[model samples]
Target chain A: MPKIVDHDQRRSEIVEAFLSVVARKGLPAATSRAIAAELGVGTGALWHYFDGFDAVTAAAYKRVTERTNERIAGASTGLRGLAAVDAMMHEILPLAKETLDEAQVVVGFWGRLAANETLSAAEADVSDMWGGRLRDHLHEAVDDGDLASGTPVDGIVDLLLSISVGQQVHAVMATPLLDPARQLALIEQCLSPWRRTPRQPGETVTR
Target chain B: MPKIVDHDQRRSEIVEAFLSVVARKGLPAATSRAIAAELGVGTGALWHYFDGFDAVTAAAYKRVTERTNERIAGASTGLRGLAAVDAMMHEILPLAKETLDEAQVVVGFWGRLAANETLSAAEADVSDMWGGRLRDHLHEAVDDGDLASGTPVDGIVDLLLSISVGQQVHAVMATPLLDPARQLALIEQCLSPWRRTPRQPGETVTR
Candidate 1:
């Protein structure tokens, strides 16, 4: 009998190859032939798992998105206030090499998806999902009286999401603010102004 | 004498065409042929002013960087503190349609430039130039005692730049924080925590 291959695992491996090439090279270099060559597989082999380049690209992006969400969600477990949000933001920012490479791929994919509707929808869905998490966290803060009552939960949610995305760009561009330690401090400072009480001299907000 | 076209003006026009193509289509689509077609000029006309595609792209990117710097300089004439930073950040973020388009192009170009030494150096120069202005403003804030004394100017500068770039990505992804107005408010709130004043009625420091 022929050995059974885990379709999900195989698909994930292909996606990883897709992401690596796209991140190292720009989106254009992430062509089907290039991906196949990178993977040392026949060009037709990719189609066996994915519909085509678009499908593969979409899947690769989805793979990144899912992994990111999972990490953020895990970090956010039982956390509240700015700590939870910061945790989520840190998870999204491009600091670690893997996350940084993932961010490059994500931005490139966003550009490529702009003109392609299917990819655009997938992009939108992922963004919306992330936004929803941010919104939920903001709402939670509001409920706990950590945030001001009149502050628009929706707006704050958006603000956090925007800052998170901006941080990724900063990271890839090697902008001064891309320093992980500084980013953490600034994020903490940024959240400070919105809090009801001044952060005590030594209180770890996360605790 | 044969009619002499203003070479600089002609190049500027070509740069504008390149920007349009880059903003509308991805950079890959902004080939010399496409730009010439957009300008209603023969394909050879571009080569008359530029060495080739890379020259046009670099020039176009420089044009954008100049335009953005001009806007920030224009907007923040005599502004200070949170207000100065606000204007600078707003100018960089994808607030309006024109800036939004520029953000997309800038981001795309930066990614492509990452691996190319010449391109990356040029891009880094633009970023440093921008950061210098920011550092100057920050130093001014510190001098005025508007910001806390112990604050790290370089760190803050990085944070500010990071937030702006992150915001651009946020806007492009259609995250909730699309509105510049709300984002500005959040930024103001974020900066408040770092101010020397203690426990203002509305302020809460959630460390």
Candidate 2:
């Protein structure tokens, strides 16, 4: 049991080293050689830990997903309904420097995800996890009279989840689509129609 | 002039072959060796025509963009306003086999684009091009009395453009977000609040 725990610890350290390389340099620069260098080990050491580059990318993808989930947990603490939804989305949307860097790292792995089913299959369906949480927060909003009855919560969940996944690549593309004000507006657009008070455009919702 | 024409012609043929390999197999299968085999040539022939795999991918990305633009023109011919928006989006949304395959091809290149600035720089900005078109179409819809007088046109334009680009990768993810109905619903979700004749939950906007 101790040996297995040590093995897991080593894998986590390697994945962290990979992310640090991606953060300082860009993704292409985060080669096995670079990751090994970051850990003060030989490139051959990475192959001993991971199957290949694809395995490292998949591990990094999962690491980023877990980090975002942790942030969401922190952001939504003691909040519920539209307020909670707004806070949770803010964590995922790449608005700040940390999340923007996370977007860059995750978006780089997506092409590999598309190409390799074995690697991608090992990762869970993000839509289900994020969609499930967003759906719950929406229902909480409805219960609190924050959103109207018959608010099409399911459709809104789908809409927001799509935006969550979509914006990662948009931020990487460095388009106006990644603009914070514009993204906040889209999030508001989703909730505005359902809000009881129906806040006006250009008005800040939570933060 | 003829020699220059032939060089361009040859590059186009190689790019087309790359697409063929991608369409029949998947993105990862569309390798230099596979592309050369698809054309019954050696992999060295491919490098002679293009600088490298990154160059081949950039060319293929540009080719796909041109092809999609051509489809948009053909689909939207003699159409305007919301009708044209629906048609143009239908062509881009990866709802069909051709577009789904195109999505696989383009999503694969995004990783390279993020990695290589020289390669990414050669491509045009998709947001500006697509956003500009969607913006005009939304204005036309408003002018024709199809949408509300005080519709937040710019916000809706940004929302729809984000979805259009975002859904390409989403579809490649093969989640429910890729569901044609769900995607079309997301589009309708954007237009619904602004429509003069608001669409009901189950109602179809257009064929």
Candidate 3:
């Protein structure tokens, strides 16, 4: 029998390559030719996976979001209650080099997505999806009595999403004077006001 | 003698042209060529006014920041106490079609500004410049007993900037359901938590 490859897996591989290319180069420079060159494949082969630039760009973003969700989900094992929520919130910001790189690429895509009507809808949907997930986590924490009473669930959700986006924006805009470690410290400090109990201060962890 | 163009005047005109082009197109689409076309001038004329694309982009952002500060300054009149502070907060968000258009361009510029080093420096300088002014205004309000005592100045500043950016992001990403009046209502609602006194039943204005 002839060897059979998973088409979806191959498409994901192409999208991963596309994200790497976007991370190194700005989105505008991540053209089909550039992505193809980075993947070490002919442009025609990339097209077999993606119909056009829009499809490829959308796929790249979807891959990033999916991988990010997976990271958070995978970290929840053997931990429950507030510990899971804390871990998820910590993972929300880009702590690792790989996650930071992903964040940089995601921020780059936001600019393109904002202006392009075709992508704008998708971007809004993705944002709301993330917001919904964060809200669910907050609600669970509230039910578990790990979060403060009278704490607005949706507001916390918005705060988490906004702060995460704000931190990435700060990372890309600010000088390396404050790298990921310093930033995570600032964020954790800001979040102290809303926490049910004080978190012992510590340096950032790469998981 | 024939009319002589001053350097400051010409620079302002060039920045205006850049903003208009960016407002119509987007940050990425606002090339020197497109800005010149929007200005009804040649690329050579634009170069004569500014050094290059980076210079123009920086200048354009500076001009917008100046305009926004001046407008906020004007809103400070005819009000006392927290009323004045709330008035200024209202103006920061886009209250009119003109400001709304400018904000769209400003929000789009943020992502590109994050990705580009030169532009990122310019943006940080602008943030510091504006944040400092805000800090000063807040300090004055505190001294005048218009704001609550013991409020963290920097926290207020961050909150203001965050909400400002958050509202713009919402406007850009979500459908414009909140009219200007309704948007003002939401602002008042957000401000309620910090106000020193409770409003009379159905009272729209603070005494």
Candidate 4:
């Protein structure tokens, strides 16, 4: 009988090797030979699973995005308004060592995006999906009377996304300032304006 | 007289060449040969001013940081409190094509920081400088009654720094959701809390 080959498993192994290579060494050193060596295989073996280095990168990126989406979706289920947003934000932050490595890989990919249109497109798609989900939660918040009727959902989503990306960079860089508690506090402050009751005329909010 | 070269000016030129090479071809192609070719000089000339490719990169990074600090200081001079913070943030953002290149170079440097301790230390120093400046301004805001008492200055500074770095990544990537106007508006919202007057008891301020 012929041996069974699980193509999906092999592809996943190749992508795992690609990410490990990228995480341990910056993307510049993540050559096909290096990735294959990481997996204890010959360089030619990578080509069997991926069209080329670019294919491998794209696949690895897809895997990262899928994992992120899965985590966010799982965390935010049955949640709405500020609570849902908080859950999603917490899920995306680099609080764990493994997630920190993921953040580093994501940062590595940012440098390549300027020169690689395909990778850039993939990243943009993931970004949009993330932003769209947040926007949906914001809309739900407003509809549920958790946010003001005229709350700028679009702007809030943009702010949250910007803060999230920025926090990822700081966390990966190990900046002394942004510990997990501080990070969570910052997110709360960004959301605070939307959480307040609709103001009466001439009432001051900030002291 | 033998040809006299101003060492400082020559160093600047080499650093410029390094940055140009990085901006045009990403960090992977920023070898001594590529930088020398960019400057219309032999690779040996780069060795004359810098010890090696690492030294050249370090010098280039120093130049970038100096340029950034100068710009922020110049822009924020005579401004105070939240105004000062706003000016500094605006100065740091990638508002022009040149700044956009700086952002790309910055993202490139971030990837290298993980593997290069010298570069990483240099980056941490710059981040501290930037954060310190922002913190000083936040302190001023509190002292001047521009913000509420117990306004969490440290957290605010961390958030601002994170948001600024994050926005730089977004702007460089040309994320459609965050244009210049939107970016500025988001910053304004982050500042809005401090801009408002303190709320009286039992008063809603969101109107």
Highest lDDT among the candidates is held by which one?
2
Rank the candidate models, highest TM-score first: 2, 4, 1, 3
Clashes of each: 12, 0, 0, 6
Top candidate when judged by DockQ against the true structure: 2
Worst 10 residues of 1 chain A by lDDT: A111-120
Sort candidate 4 into its docking category. Answer: acceptable
- Alpha-carbon RMSD, each predicted model: 5.9, 1.7, 4.9, 6.9
Better of 2 and 3 by DockQ: 2
Lowest-sum lDDT 10-residue window in model 2 chain B: B198-207
Question: Cα lDDT of model 1 overall?
Answer: 0.68
Model 3 stretches astray by more than 4 angstroms: A1-11, A22-34, A42-55, A77-85, A175-207, B1-11, B21-34, B42-56, B77-85, B94-96, B136-150, B175-207
- lDDT tens readout by residue for model 2, A1-207: 999998888899999998898788877788888999999999998787789988888888899999999988988888899888999889989897888878877777777766776766767687799999999999999999989998999988988987887788788778888888888888988878778987765555563
TM-scores for chain B, in order? Answer: 0.77, 0.95, 0.72, 0.78
Residues A2-96, candidate 3, lDDT per residue (tens digit)? 22366787787888777777667655567788888887888888877777876777777677778777878898665554566557766666666
Candidate 4 structure quality by residue, lDDT tens digits, A1-207: 122357878899988887777667755567788988888888998787777766776677678777777888787778887678878887777776656767766765665564354566666465577788899988988898878787778877877888877776786577864577777767766766667564455543221
How much is A107 displaced in model 4, in angstroms? 0.7
Q: Residue A90 in model 4: shift from native, Å?
A: 1.5
Candidate 3, B75-156: lDDT as tens digits: 7666654565566666667666656665566555665664465566566454455556667766776777655676456655
Per-residue C-alpha lDDT of model 1 across residues B1-207, encoded as one tens digit per residue: 123558888899999988888678755577788889999989997898988665675677688888988998898887876567767777777778888777666655654443233554556465567678888877777788878877667755655566666665555556556666766655554455456664356552221
- Candidate 1 vs candidate 2: the lDDT winner is 2
Q: Over the stretch A1-207, how does candidate 1's per-residue lDDT look in tens digits?
A: 132457777788888887778667755567788888988988998888887776776677788888888998798888975567777877887768778777666665654453243555666465577777777777777788887776555645554565666666565566666677766666555455456666776566563
